[model samples]
Target: MPSSFSSQMLSSGGLGLAAGLSLIVAIGVQNAFVLRQGIRQEHVGAVVAVCAVSDAVLITAGIAGLGAVVEQADGVLRWLTWFGAAFLIGYGLLAVRRALRPSAGLEAERAATTTSVAAAVSTALALTWLNPHVYLDTVVLLGSIGNGEGPSGRWWFAGGAVLASLLWFTILGYGARLLAGFMSRPSSWRILDGLVALVMLTLGVLLLVRG
Candidate 1:
């Protein structure tokens, strides 16, 4: 009986990890921001830390049943939707400006536009916190699914999800340097920034239209 229970818990944890990765592995605004910071090699550690820790908190909240609370908070969601849309639009404009500017090599541009650590951290926080989808995925969806694991199994499930977040951010932030050779050209930066702008703008507009 004990062994059977253990097998079920392991299965639950594996499912949690898979579900978390499925939701998170997409190329969204937060991922784009993290990739850019990683390429720039500016405060990458801090950015990764922020993202991982935020995920941990949210996942834990979900596992602890805060998801139900969030679901009932219509006013909070509305406020976040409006605020997030505004923030994304502003950030998207910056990306557009970067894309339009005369580009330099990635390293040269990094040197020229070296952002303060605090500023980078602030941007990371904003990117992680402002998006309503983050709440929905981490708190509502993940939470509801985790709660289905029953009390003891839910913690293991949350652990698996948190581990996924940590592994993903660490690999993305640190391993981004591997693409330095390809992203060395000035034109590469322009293309990347343009894509980032499009993503941010589209998400922002969608939030406004849908919300």
Candidate 2:
């Protein structure tokens, strides 16, 4: 009995770690925004913390059987995808507009001053919650994998997954910020914003068009 228990525990731990790592390893739009903000070295700490904490909350919710509820809701995924796509496209358009408009140094300073922690937190939450992929990855996929384990194993799996998300967002936000100096130029911002626009438009169109 002891041996069987030990074996089960080990298996569960392995499974949890695998599930956590697999989902968090992929780069998505949220990560891209975090990276961009980080590289700009603007609100580095706030950005990383908000992103990590938001992810932790979502992962925990998924583990708490939230996945089942989400699964039962008809058209939940489709609606989420649409909302996410719209936000992305709208945000990208704003970025493109900013890139096109060259602000005076005084106006730029005032703009920077207005970027508060609350705004950062709100943005992070929006980015995290708007994405339907988060639901599929955390709630459905991770939750399914975790459900296979025993009670203790479920916690372990959740821990691993949360750890993965926290680590990735934290690192991406801080590490990318180091590049802010290089990305500070108006031309650089323009190019970066343009790419962001393209990505948002593509993702939005794809989601809306998807049957």
- Deviation in Å, model 2, residue 166 alpha carbon: 0.8
Cand. 1 TM to true fold: 0.96
lDDT of 1 by residue, 42-123 (tens): 8999999999999999999988989999999999999999999999999999999999888669878888889999999999
lDDT, model 1, position 98 = 90
lDDT of each: 0.90, 0.72
- At residue 205, candidate 1 shows an lDDT of 98
Mark the 10 consecutive residues where model 2 has the least summed lDDT: 104-113
lDDT (Cα, tens digit) per residue for candidate 2, span 1-211: 8997777666776676677667776656677678767765667688778767766676677778898898888587777888888887777677668657764433352365356778766777787788777787888788877776767677777777777777787788877756666575666666666776676666667767872
Q: What count of clashes does model 1 give? A: 0
Task: Please report how far candidate 2 places residue 17 from its true position, in Å.
Answer: 4.1
**Model 1 residue 65 lDDT score:** 86
* lDDT computed for candidate 2: 0.72
